[model samples]
Target: MLSKLLIGVGAAALCATATISLADTSDKRIALSNNYAGNSWRQAMLASWEKVTGAAVADGTVAEAPAFTTAENQVTEQAAQIQNMILEGYDAIVINAASPDALNGAVKQACDAGIVVVSFDGIVTEPCAYRIAVDFHAMGKVEVEYLATRLDGGDLLEIRGLAGVFVDDEISAGIHEGVAENPQFKIVGSVHGDWAQDVAQKAVAGILPSLPEISAVVTQGGDGYGAAQAFAAAGRPTPLIVMGNRYDEMLWWKEQKDANGYETMSVSIAPGVGTLAFWVAQMILDGKEVPQDLTVPFLTITQDTLEDSLAATQPGGVANVEYSLEDAMAVVSGG
Candidate 1:
């Protein structure tokens, strides 16, 4: 099994409780080669990198760590970004990749250049690159599992993330797997929301006219509130819409919960998985014997945990949690 790394509780606890001695990497530098930044989660991810890596730099853990994203969420665009990182001569490159395997050549180039490469969230399948992976397939499957408890069988609307991104495919596939296991529910419509609120709102609104009564709107994050908005605007009754951990979505869930005992679950990888990637890259440069593949649990907010999570989250930010040197050491030693 891949080791589970529990760095900290959330952003509020990002303050390092303990520190480990840095390996011979104080002079090294790392760069984040991101593929896209079009949504709240992506924006918060960049912010987390800056927040954690900024402190790491100030403390001389690494000489530098900067994030760069592409204007277009495409394979060639991200491949070019990876190539640029290789040319700049960074000691390590942390990636939220555009494709699972398409950028293997560019990542291999970095590995051949003796540069450490770490991919997270939208991870690459390149064997040479270390991965801080998420169980996105399980993330999707559990959404339907959650719905099954509240909903027996009904028509559904599926709002997916960016088209062609491997994350989207995995999550959607898991949702379908859940439906197959249950056999009571059926998906009536599917659309690409690109993991954006406005895009999701418009897409859901457009499709609501055609879809049969949606019992639950399954999503790939950043689309729950928009789905709710579309239902309200269209004068259709709200369904059990699952949420990604965005502030607005949680807030809307909160309002609905208070007004009536409306209930659903929110789940997503905390955006600070970026900070975990940063520390993992630093650990590799620190000469820690780390596995190439590892997994982190997604944050799930349920009826009972909603208030606490909502309190911990920053306004307009994700419920993120950063990692520390000690946390990385635990992963390295399998503690």
Candidate 2:
């Protein structure tokens, strides 16, 4: 009787161990759904996602992380792609939405199907989905405020971002707020850079001939370098250009500061914020509690920190950094 009882206990212990092992080794399939792939920032964001998800695959934390990009900036197409992901049975989906409100229904469908959904950068308005974003309004206010300190009220040219994007609109509104408060600073004109270098250069080049003498240029990211290039090509002294955090822009600004004491500042949404969303999804899969909304602060690169930013950047890439899983958890837990 004693021997039989011992065998029963041992068998129960073995079953418990096997169950735990199976749970540990279970695969989590993740998918990244991006809206547009036109700009370097978007490319860098994709790179960040690839790096993190690749590591997860190696460690058996992720089963798959297939990335998909839309050729055009259309919400309907993105929604359809997401619906396909639902049918394909993705464990999690990270999105850089094309529109804030347009993807709500699809995102809701994903949530209903028991898939974890997280949005960043160009975020979605689906309340059921998790969001990790920087405060763009604050970013805009700060960018304009930094330029205001130097210009002390002058003809500031505003280079807006992609039309109809929530981030672009919020930042523009914040800039207008800053301009309104600082009565000395006046926005003489505005143009759409579409947050691309060549595009911004062409747009600025076209408008420079018609606009009055500008004292400063306030630009969204991916356009600062091009705007400077346009001014240089036009044989005009470049105004105090507040830049976004791009590697090429940082390199240019650093060289200018070294050569001519050209002073400026840069701030933008970090490409690695995508990685933050990746880790957030991983945590949720691991049965860790995370918030519905989380905020990662924007990376602010000034002259003093430019060298460090450059050193941290990958060669031929933008200034980017990824947060570790522990670091992400800290942000989520308010730690």
Candidate 3:
């Protein structure tokens, strides 16, 4: 009777362990490579990711597998890291590729090695895996339309992000589409800000004296703040219409509004990209089918839309609306 009881107890224990293992695949680890942590949006995104997945890391309780931040914004570094992940036999890889095409070879290598790769935020035009992104073209066109309504026929200074990026290219195309529809709006000067605050400030400062006819500035969110600083320094009396930048720097925008009397607009792209990346990772781990393209909704936030806009910013400062693993799974399955 005692021997029979011992055997039964051992069998139950083994079954429970196996069931727990099957429920959460946290043991299936993944690596995340962000394009760079060079801005407020990226920082906010990193914090959000930690908040969502930190508990699992702390308790070593991955319902799926391990996920970690492996590299930041270097194309070469990303390639090396992906190679390492392949060697380590990770189940999935989530990357925010710095360049649209530069990471293609590395991505192909990952696929060749039978590892799952999903790129988000920025895309690799070459199809090695899944892609999740914001509709940058729509974002740009929407922003330009807003600017067009604010101005009739004024000289506009445009601030651009990194050159040759898909986001930049697509957004530029959208802006052109909007601008072409309104011929009265003239582009006085267009400068590359590289999406950096200091870079934008310097770029706009240099152009201000030469193109003083600037009626309003159209630019990336980061460049929007820089344009405001430039306008203040140059004593330019023009309003700025921009995409999401200075997300946590609302005080700065309010101060600028009071002092410079210029208005700004932005879309929360970071959270969208983060949530998408997490979903792609989940799909890869589940051995599920992933769509070639996944686009998240982008919201425009202005002083008028402040209340609605603030509602979307996650409590942890994440850019997108908060969602769970289950929600992400739903999206993956549906897509």
Candidate 4:
């Protein structure tokens, strides 16, 4: 009988110092079930999956590892996609889900069908599915903690991610928690950036007229530069805006640093964590007794590393690191 496995993971950097022998099952097939692909971050994620899994398929690591994404970022659409992947008889399905609880029913069905289901980023809450989750709460809190060292206290403008998503909720909660603890900073205005530059710009522009002087802007990702743009266009002085790891954001920081000695940090996970999910599925299919969950860490770029990160990043791409099978095994070994 197949053993039911569930794992709870903490946020840590990916470790790959340990090596392990593998079991063989090269005939297995895997599939990626992604919810949305609207923003550059999602676009970069899809590209990473294709590059890594395409190589896996070419090298015969798996028979097929096709990816599917939904046009609308809806739970119903993604559930239907999962059902179809099940009907198609895929051996494993890795998800960047739309909902944590809303997709649990479909996830259960997939697990009951004996398919190895691994979720990352937007993870599911089903007991049978394995999660490779990020410490997004810590991420949000860290942004504030970093800011506390720089400023005494002032009004903050908050830029949120997609509304009603788990990541948005968790990160926002952490930010709020940090604010509560610090008590020095007050959020005077808030808007949903939808994790897009144009959206953030418009939202910030709409709210800027009524708020107090913002000492800083807090963001989810893909919104920092837009926030900066809104401030410039409004003739408001620039504020310390936290950045996501998008290339454009870093590039703008480098430009500002050169012109004004601006200093800030960038925090985000690479889109390449999907590749780690791919290897987890492959290891499971190979009959390796791997751990159920993986800890996905966030990447932070300080002022000193901004130029190097910008150089490493493609014009429209985000800072990224693709994991190898060895990295996956190290995660399994708890290294």
Which model scores highest in TM-score? 4
TM-scores for all candidates: the values are: 0.76, 0.77, 0.70, 0.79
lDDT of 3 by residue, 1-335 (tens): 34533543554465466644322345656667666776556776666666665654556544443334435567888778767777876666777777888888888877776666777776677686888767778777776688777767777778888998767887777777878887787777899988776898899899888885676677765666677677779887756657453444344565666776657667546554565576567544544445777776565567776545455554324335544667666666765
What does candidate 2's lDDT look like per residue over 1-335, in tens digits? Answer: 34433543454465566644222313778899999988677888888888887887888777888889988989999999999999898878999999989899999999877788999888888999999878889888998889766776789889999999877998899899989988898988899999888999999999998878889999888899999999999999889998887778888898999899999999887888998998888777665667899988788888899889988886656777787788788889982
Stretches of candidate 3 off by over 4 Å are 1-28, 34-42, 55-77, 98-114, 125-128, 149-153, 162-169, 209-213, 247-249, 256-263, 284-289, 304-335
Which candidate would rank higher by lDDT, 1 or 3?
1
For model 3, where is the 10-residue window of minimal lDDT?
Answer: 61-70
Let me know the TM-score candidate 4 reaches against the reference structure: 0.79
Tens digits of per-residue lDDT for model 4, 1-335: 13322211110111122234344446778999999999777888899899999998899889999999988999999999999999998889999999999999999999888888999888899988888888889889989998999999999999999999878998899889999999999989989999899999999999999998999999998899999999999999999999998888998999999999999988988888899889988887766666666677778899998888899899988998787899878876872
Error of 1 at 282 (Å): 1.9
lDDT of 3: 0.66
Provide the overall lDDT of each model, using Cα atoms, as 2-decimal numbers: 0.86, 0.85, 0.66, 0.87
Write one digit per residue (lDDT tens) for candidate 1, span 265-322.
9999888888888888887776556788988767889999988888988888777766
The candidate 2 region of ten consecutive residues with least summed lDDT is 17-26
- Name the runs in model 1 displaced over 4 angstroms: 1-24, 35-39, 68-89, 98-103, 151-155, 162-165, 188-194, 202-214, 233-236, 311-317, 326-335
lDDT of candidate 2 vs native?
0.85
Off by over 4 Å in 2: 1-27, 35-39, 69-84, 87-89, 148-153, 163-166, 202-214, 233-236, 311-317, 333-335
